[model samples]
Target: MNFTGVSGQLQFDLEKNLIQPAYDVLNIGGTGFRKIGYWSNSSGLSTTEPETLYGKSFNTSTRTPHLYSVIWPGETIATPRGWVFPNNGRPLRIAVPERVSYKDFVSKDKSPPGVRGYCIDIFEAAINLLPYPVPRTYMLYGDGKRNPQYTDLVGQVALNNFDAAVGDVTITTNRTRMVDFTQPYMESGLVVVVPVKQVKSNPWAFLKPFTIEMWLVTGAFFLLVGVVVWILEHRINHEFRGPPREQLMTIFWFSFSTMFFSHRENTVSTLGRLVLIIWLFVVLIINSSYTASLTSILTVQQLTSRIEGIDSLISSNDPIGVQDGSFSWKYLVNELNIAESRLVTLKTMEDYIKALQDGPKRGGVAAIVDELPYIELFMSATKCAFRTVGQEFTKSGWGFAFQRDSPLAVDLSTAILQLSENGDLQKIHNKWLRSSECSMQLNEMDADRLSLTSFWGLFLICGIACFIALAVFFCRILLQYRRFSPETVEGDVEEIELPPRSGRRSLRTASFKNLMDFVDKKEIEIKHMLKRKSSDNKQEASPSSDGKSHSPS
Candidate 1:
């Protein structure tokens, strides 16, 4: 009954003597004899029984019992029972469920007609990491009419129907009770998939980068800079000094045109040039940043959605989609507290698309919630028809399934860990799922837009500079007006001293009139001086003429 020393032994004698003379046989493990079965060349295999076979020798002089045991290469001794069993040498039966999209996971068109996909490639790569080779055969489960649920696929391993169930089989706590799984090779989680509703282009989309307040502030600064430049240069710079209408046009033209660095006015005063320099730099920065931000906003479509995240979908009381029999269904029902009445069960990518297109008002789901792999696959195929919203929730991963206590699980897990670290897993994923059509959409969704908040400090700096320049211009105008006031007169003109009773009224009335009178007096004195100089020149010329006439005689 005990197989103590049979570990190293190649073969053991089943029985010593018999009429037929049966020879040596191999043991399955080093455990006590449990039962035996018969393997015959003609009659076919028979049931295993405890007793051995007996043969008649005619005289019945010798008697022997037929012993039988199953054996293969790479068999190891089972602990406690000391049973010798081959873990890898035998062909492993792998169960694959029938799914059209998932057919790539295990296809019949291949040379051997078996499994191959993101999951299958990962499984084979992990197995290859071991020192020995593993021979395997794939048995597809489910009727051809419908794809099997993940539960039914994993159940095959639990029922001892196959060594493992390999596919996009998700690992969950409920399934863990029935079967053991290796370390997760693919990270999986639920995501909200909504129709990629195109955002209508705003006629004012160009103005979105900066807020209304910012735009208003920017416009005000533009005008302020223009008016300050005109005030400082109007008297000296002829280009700026013109008729009222022409001057008004010049102010605006110079201010706005500076945005494009195409102004015509030339600043003459030192103060005017300083202001212009600062203003020009500010305009350059503003224009450059505005162009950059505006370009980004237009090139990268700004997508907007009613359902920003899972919470929004729930709060809106809109119908939600759950892939039939996916873990997301249970997650929605239990974790999210979504009512069954609101949940719409979807079975395929087409179903997801149809539900989203139908919209919430027409008995369609507002959003579809499913695993990330399926979502990615769906998005890639549809080319931006739908987009995944919200952060992934209820984290889980996909892994190969095995019966509880299977010895291969540990080794397979170890191999998988090695593959993951070596980057083989990512390479497999890329081979199966990578696509370029949706790359722009995916990247655009992830990119952030420029907001007014990003450039508020720059705008503030420009605004402050413009306001200071305006204040300086106004102060200069006031100083010039004071310099021409009558109170500072120094010629022999008598100062009119008002009578005591009329002093207040006289001061108030005469202030403006006296200022005008001073301007008139200055003009008259300039004309008189010119006349006196002209007469003196004429007299000197006449005397010179007389002298020349006498010299000629």
Candidate 2:
């Protein structure tokens, strides 16, 4: 059979020959990853070459599963005796499961530490992160699907499980619950996903320091207020240095006119004008810093942790959230000896990410999460993502899970250690270290939270707020202690009532409003009557003064 020079046939033959190897490589991505080496020349990851390989799917439910085999290099094939490697070299082929090998085409996870497939690793690592002496864990088991048996579990009943059960369980109910939730573990609660009808206002942004717009408004308001006060009180048409009754009338007129005539006058003193300018500065500059601090627009919190380390999270009474069934969730509720009520378990990675952003149940959350890569995945999808710090709250050993408490746990750990000892762990780690979601950065929230520095921003924010409040109170005290009224000190138009703003709603205000309404109505009626009389007079008069009056026909 001379096969030569047939282009169509040749191409077909080439493709046919390539198909098996390609399929094998696609299935045995782990083996191909090894052959490809640890670092890709482009991405700097050996196994995760092209980066997207880890997220690829098999397109079919995989069966071969890339069963791991520990082998020696260069099998010494005797005619009959069987496999052997030379020089006692341990040539290993870790048959990574196609569903879980980070390089496998069927794997969907970007981070191998917390994904459902990664939980076994996390469990192992978290166990190791603790101070030995494993707690006899009584795990609450569920595969995340609805359990027909727990039909009675609804709202507070399901939520109350947190109190009744000894550990964390993910919640899915949406109706309001009377029971309190711990931090989220596996799922976020309900969401209202609707397109914004209009551009929405920033949430509580007013709590932030003054914006440039606000600063401008503040400057204008203060300047305008001060100038109006200076003009009406200091340089008005009325006589000053006088007694009570006349002074009240002058103040009333000033109070009324100054609102509109703020910019109309030029009688304000230089010192008074300077004071207005200073007030503008305070409004513009001082409040801007205040607003920024209050709103927390700065990502300085990202640079550090809220609690710092795993130890802090483990030790604190603070409620912690975890993606249910995750290593962090397991460790905190089990090994760390945190109460079940202290753990909030969410159902999905998305919910867990959201729970982290939602923060603590008691004003703040202390969470245990996969240290870096897991957080990076969240930042890849959303802004204002959270972080973990302080010695990786728990280190997780990445592994494919089997049915609970299976002997595969130990076997897999042994296999993983074997791979680690032979540098496969480094290879895997290096591969993941380059993905954008994995590589961006990490917030050692705990480390930073506990560090002398991260707490400093909070200290400063609180300190400044306290200082301002104290200053305001102290200034008011000095003013109050003296017989001088606020009307004199700031040239305020309103009379200083001896009582607090809370003294009463002021029936006088209602009476004054009613009196004004009556006067306005009477004035309108008088004008109408006068117009009618004038018309009648024009119809009846012959002459007035030096003019003849015309009569209506």
Task: Please name the candidate that would achieve the greatest TM-score relative to the true structure.
Answer: 1
What residue pairs clash in candidate 1, if any at all? Answer: 28-84, 29-83, 29-84, 30-84
TM-score of each: 0.68, 0.28
Distance from true position, residue 134, model 1, in Å? 4.1
For residue 498, give model 2's deviation from the true position in Å. Answer: 33
lDDT (Cα, tens digit) per residue for candidate 1, span 1-553: 2233432213234663222223333344445334454533222233432124433112222323344434433542222223223553467788877665545444444556455666778888887776544667888877755556788778878998888988788899889999999989888888888876444677986776666666777787788889878877765677886577998999899989988899877888777887888888877877777786666666654334478778888888889988765767777888889898999887667788788888888888888888888887888778877887678876899888988897677778999999878888778878888552544442233243445576677667666766777678657544544654354433334558878999888777677665544433332353454465468679999999989988955
In model 1, the Cα lDDT at residue 438 comes to 48
Candidate 1, residue 390: the lDDT equals 70
* Residue 242, model 1: Cα distance from true site in angstroms: 2.3
Candidate 2 lDDT over 451-495, as tens digits, reads 223233433443344345445533643443243322332234454
**Going through the candidates in order, what is the number of backbone clashes in each?**
4, 45
How much lDDT does each candidate structure score? 0.69, 0.37
